[model samples]
Target: MVALSFISLVGCEASVATHPVSGKVVLADGSPVGGGIIKFRTKSDEGETVKAHGQIQPDGSFQLTTFQDGDGALEGEHEAILFSPATGDGHNAVAAPNFPTKYRKYETSGLKFQVGPGENDFVIQLGTR
Candidate 1:
């Protein structure tokens, strides 16, 4: 059963355990954002920065995933940024930021979250411009 043993080993090596992280995005008025994207970036103890991203649902819920779907993010502190596609007039070609421009950059957003060894659930509140 050498082949069987090898197959099992391969499968185990391919799967990495991850902590679960989920959150909700809401505005200052406490209304859910219809659509957007959320991202988390953190520097590991090794000094390498890792990023995880998730799509904001219509109900403003999101789950962070790094390597695989729903696999979750690396454990540590993270800076978060939220973004939604800005609408542009037919005459203007450039699309502006839908949310506050300050929120588009992780460093400027003033949004931070710490991920522990276990599951993390967070509620992110956004301020109006």
Candidate 2:
């Protein structure tokens, strides 16, 4: 009974609020990235790091989801990372030829964005270098 009560309490506690984030991933020449994964990572005021990610659409558009589908991410400064590898095996395979590998890691990606209240939209450009 005690364990059940604890679980119920935990479930009842509200989750961190998230704002809607949408964006488009493009290249320096203004061409859409087509297929890839884009992530937005940031640390909350409480020092807990949170992340939101989305699959880059054929049109390079994406909608971030942190906790739930289309729920978005926490508002704050975020580092962006976009990576698309050549065709492989599985549902995670993304066909992004000529995509730079440096953008795969956040530390070397050199991409950043600031999320605000309400709807936060962006257009991220990745370089071939």
Candidate 3:
């Protein structure tokens, strides 16, 4: 049974603690983004970074998941990046940009949030600039 005990310990050690994270993505006019992705990346004090991702729904609502579905993200400071695929024409159609190009990259998005030990509900606002 020694091997079984060791396996259990390994499994426990591989799990990371996470908290629930949910939010809405809206424009300056308070309109929903429709469809897209939202990513939350954190720079940890231990020099390791963790990332969580959520898909924006039709109503612009989203629930973040890190290791599992709706499991949320690690508690820390995070940089949020919003990506909305162009929607318009059909096949052979050019895709238009939704938010500003700067918001697509985590380094330049300028959107920051703090995930606490409990539930985190945020409202992300996108601007023209």
Clashing pairs in 3: none
Candidate 2 worst ten-residue window by lDDT = 8-17
Q: Highest lDDT among the candidates is held by which one?
A: 3
Query: Where does model 2 exceed 4 Å of error?
Result: 1-13, 85-94
User: Quick one: ranking by lDDT, best first?
Assistant: 3, 2, 1
Candidate 2 whole-model C-alpha lDDT, 0 to 1: 0.83
Off by over 4 Å in 1: 1-17, 85-97
Ranking by TM-score: 2, 3, 1
Alpha carbon lDDT of each predicted model:
0.81, 0.83, 0.83
Model 1 — which ten-residue stretch has the worst lDDT? 9-18
Show pairs that collide, candidate 2: none
**Candidate 1 C-alpha lDDT tens digits along 86-115:** 545778754332778888898799999998
